[model samples]
Target: MHTEPTAQATATTHPAPTDPACDALDGGPATELCAPRRGRPRSEAAEQAIFAAVEELMEAGRSLSDLSVERIAAAAGVGKATIYRRWPNKEALLVDVVARLEAPAPVRTSTDGSVRDELIAMVEYMRQRGLAKRSRWMLKSALSQMNSWPELREAYQEQVVRPRRAMARAIVRRGVEEGVLRSDLDIELLCEIVIGPILLRTVLWDEAPLEDPGLPEQMVDAVLNGVAAPPPDGRSR
Candidate 1:
């Protein structure tokens, strides 16, 4: 319910997207979510209206599964036929809704600077994301459902983890290529090492609260100083 930009998930931002808010809950388009966009050249106005309604519903304190197509159509001032034409089912609609809300992959900064700085940025990004309102809840909910249904786990990995890994991989790769990072280290392994603690703190353990002062720096040290250990020369090669 605390929708204001808290500290979860990449700075915990969510101030009702500036400009006229678009649907933040899409899995891309209807096809991606398995909603056949068949029929006439669907009404653009209708689609926008539905997407907007989705945003409003969430902002107004309604969840994805809690909403119905009938309610959405009515809220958008459109017809049931128009709603059903694009989205075959509520799940597909919800998928699209989630996709819309999803943020893009994190941006990689110059690792050529220092391994310390690169990793600090990565941890900061994860820490901020962990502090987000909906994202934090979503992660906790996913783990709870992972026992009965594993796809929720996969969905979380696909949507959240994969993008983050890609970002971290790039940073690590850049460091290695520039000789700023040790060449022998496995980048993927490094990726897991870098992010595992953040996930543990944020998702699994939930021991370290984001409000804890100086925690971000501690996290950065735990990852960097461990993985990017200097070579036998007793200095970073």
Candidate 2:
């Protein structure tokens, strides 16, 4: 008797290789979908070179529009296919670069939940990052093209702006809970108040230097003492 032939095993479809750098880009928390496993081992050297090339171009005052995938690939010493395989297009690549540059190390503050101290540290951090000359040009470029390139704007907000704001809001909420600030405070407005100065200074007065080294202190003081309620006898006034 002839035995029935065994059924052939179905082959699994393997996904193409992805850039491992995407997993730790800026070391921020990324979803699994965003950072897929690499089918092939990643080249650390190539990834570093690509990042350096993008940063170098931005630091040298090159317009984002002037950059192309080919130029970046050439500078990175990798083929166009490599860049394309990682990022679908130039805009996506630029967003990743901006995210990496803008994502600062997490801000640490007093463990006692002191809002004033926390605010001061946060402001100083923002001032340093926002006013840096090299990054300023890149921010300006991103802001200018937001209307035309909505995806770029969304990426910027998602990768750079939103995380910082969420952190700041949490700090404010903690302040309210710890009696450091008034319970009736408008958290969103307070965050905006602290960040407004930095935005104005960076974008509106690009040519001028920030003269006040104690600006962070000034901001914290205004938020804490200035807005704080006066004593029953008005002794605080």
Candidate 3:
């Protein structure tokens, strides 16, 4: 079963100001706080509208370079200032939109101690996500524009890649700790071993509908158990 990656950060009150006046009558500096207090709390309606606008534009064949703050503001029916307040630029907005899209959840370590099974499940989950129609389009869009928009690439790496990699690395580390995998294994390399083939087939080759039901299990087996034939019963090969 797939479980969504939980938010690592929690929203709590910011630390009280160190300024001595903060402890006095009026809370903190009015000049600093009152300015923001005037606006409505960020509207979820506006946020979703903006995300939909970007996706709709992309689906209509507009590249990221073709998008502008004004255009998005018009599309979302919110003021340009609203968009700017949430995302400083189009690249940042697109990164967030893509990040929030429905995709396979990261695979967490299983409690049953079956590392191989967990690895297979993760591979399958990633495969499903990568082969999804919307995901494929998003990947294509990102790849085509990433060369010209370095910040877009950076945002993607920061928001999506790092968290996913962290989850994969953690699971690999757990395998080593449980003696299911070799102690000397490079966690990063192990992660690539599991994800590399799917990426190669789907992204590099544009292979569609990656429908091999056994692919995930086969991949995990190849990584955990060698491809070499086993020795005959009672004798070393």
Best model per lDDT: 3
Stretches off by above 4 angstroms in model 2 are 1-42, 56-62, 100-105, 108-113, 133-139, 207-211, 227-237
Candidate no. 2 TM-score:
0.67
Q: Write the per-residue lDDT of candidate 1 for residues 1-237, one digit (tens) a residue.
A: 111112223322121111111112223321132222335454555666788887787677665546788788778777777666666566545545554544333344333456667666667656665665335454344235445545434554444444445556766677677776677979887667667777777667555677654675787676556656678889866
Better of 1 and 3 by TM-score: 3
Report the poorest 10 consecutive residues by lDDT, candidate 3. Answer: 16-25
Q: Ten residues in a row with the worst lDDT in model 1? A: 15-24
On TM-score, the leading prediction is 3
Our tally of clashes for model 3 stands at: 0
Give me the runs in candidate 3 sitting further than 4 Å from their true place.
Answer: 1-41, 107-113, 133-139, 232-237
lDDT of 1 at 106: 37
How does model 3 fare in lDDT?
Answer: 0.63
Off by over 4 Å in 1: 1-52, 55-70, 79-105, 109-115, 134-156, 212-214, 226-237
Displacement of residue 68 (Cα, Å) in model 1 is 4.4
Please give the TM-score that candidate 3 achieves against the real structure.
0.72
Ranking by lDDT: 3, 2, 1
Give the higher-lDDT candidate: 1 or 2. 2
